[model samples]
Target: MTQPSDVLYYSHNLNPRVAVAVARHLRAPLRYVRADPMGREREAFRPINPNTRVPILVEPSLTLWETDAIAMRLAARFDPDFWPPARREEVMLWVSWSAHHFTSAGGVLYFEHIIVPRYLDRAPDHAATAAAEADFRTFAAILDEALAGRRWLVGDAPTYADFRVASALPFAEAARLPLEPFAHIRRWHAQLEEFDAWREPFAGLD
Candidate 1:
C-alpha cells in the first residue's frame, strides 16, 4: 500500500490553526505550497475550496477546507480523544466553552488588535479593541482558574482544545497582551511551544 501524503498550502498571514493541531498531534510533517492572496489561480484549487482560504489540506485522496472543520475531521480520523469528550455531556461542555466562549472571545481580540493592524494596515477603533480585549481577558481568567492545578485543558492529557487555544497566543503576543501574571498559562504555552512539529512548519516561512 502507498503511504498517504499530507500537504498544507498556506501563507504567513494565515495562521493555519487546524493544520497545526493535526500536524502536531499526528507528528506528520507537512509539505507547504505557498499561494498568493489571489490564490493558486488554478481551477483545481477553486473546485476544492470555494472560499479560497489558505491552510487547505491535500491528503492523497481528500481535500479539506475550513480550518476548524478540518481539524475536527482529522482528530476523529486519527485521534478521537483529541476531538472532544467521548461522553455526550462533556462534548457539549467542551463545545460550549470553546466555540461559544473561548474562540469567539479570542478571535475578536486577535482580529481587532493584532490582525487588523498587520493585514489591514490600520488599527481597530479604540472602543472596539477595548471591548474585545476585555472579552479575551475574561475568558483567559476562567481558563487560568480552571487550569489552576492542571496541566491540560480537557484532562490530564492534552487535546486539540489546547492546540486551538495556543494558536492564538502569537497574535496575543503581537498585540502586547501581557501574560506576566498568568503563570499557569505561561507554563502551559511554554510546554506546547517545545514541540518540534509545531516549530518545523514555520522554518522556511520565517
Candidate 2:
C-alpha cells in the first residue's frame, strides 16, 4: 500500500505563514490542508490540536502543534542549515529573544491594527494601540541594534531564528509597524523578501 504523505494543516495567518514557508523552502513532503479554526470544522480540528490551531503537522503516528516545534521538526528531517548545530546556540538565542521581546511586542500592534479592522470590524481602542506601539518601538530598537552589522540574525546565512524574529515583519506595512528608522532591520528583511517562499508561502494553495 502506498502510504499518504504527512499532512500539514494551515491557514494564511502569521505563524502558519512561517511554517508553510519553512516547509516549502526545505521541499518537505507534506500534503497541505487548509483548516479554519473558528469554522464548522472547529470540532473536527480539536482531535488534532486542542488549541484548534493551524500549522499543525500530523504524521502517520505523530501529531504536533506550535510553529516553532513544527519548523524545528522539518529542519531536523530535511535541512539543518535552518538550525545549524554548530551555530544552534546563537540561533536559539535570537529565536528566544524574538518570542519574548520582538514578535511578542509587534503581535499586539498587528492584532490591534490589522485583526481588529479586518476581522473584528470594530474600532480598535486607541489607548491599547498606543501602548502596543510604544512596546513595539522599545523592542524594535533592540533588534535594530542587534542587526546593525549583520545581514542575518545568527550566522553568515539565514536561519530559523531570522524567520522567527521576522514573523511579524511581513505584516509590518499593513500593521503599521514603526520600522522606518531601522535601516539594518529593513535591509535584513529586504534580503528575506528575496525568497519566493517567504514572499508568498501560501501562494496557489487553498
RMSD of each predicted structure: 3.4, 1.7
Best by TM-score: 2
Query: lDDT values of the candidates?
Result: 0.66, 0.88
Give per-residue CA lDDT, model 1, range 52-148, as digits (tens).
6677888888888766666776776777777654743444465557666666666676677767876686758778767766776777788778778
lDDT of 2: 0.88
Q: Quote the lDDT for 52 in model 2.
A: 83
Query: Candidate 2 — which residues are off by over 4 angstroms?
Result: 1-4
For model 2, residues 1-206, the per-residue Cα lDDT tens digits are: 66457999998888899899999888898988898976778899898898888889999888999999999899999999889988888888888888897898888888888889888958988887788788888888888998997778888988899899999999998888999988889999999999988988988799
RMSD of 1: 3.4
| Residue pairs with clashing backbones, model 2 | none
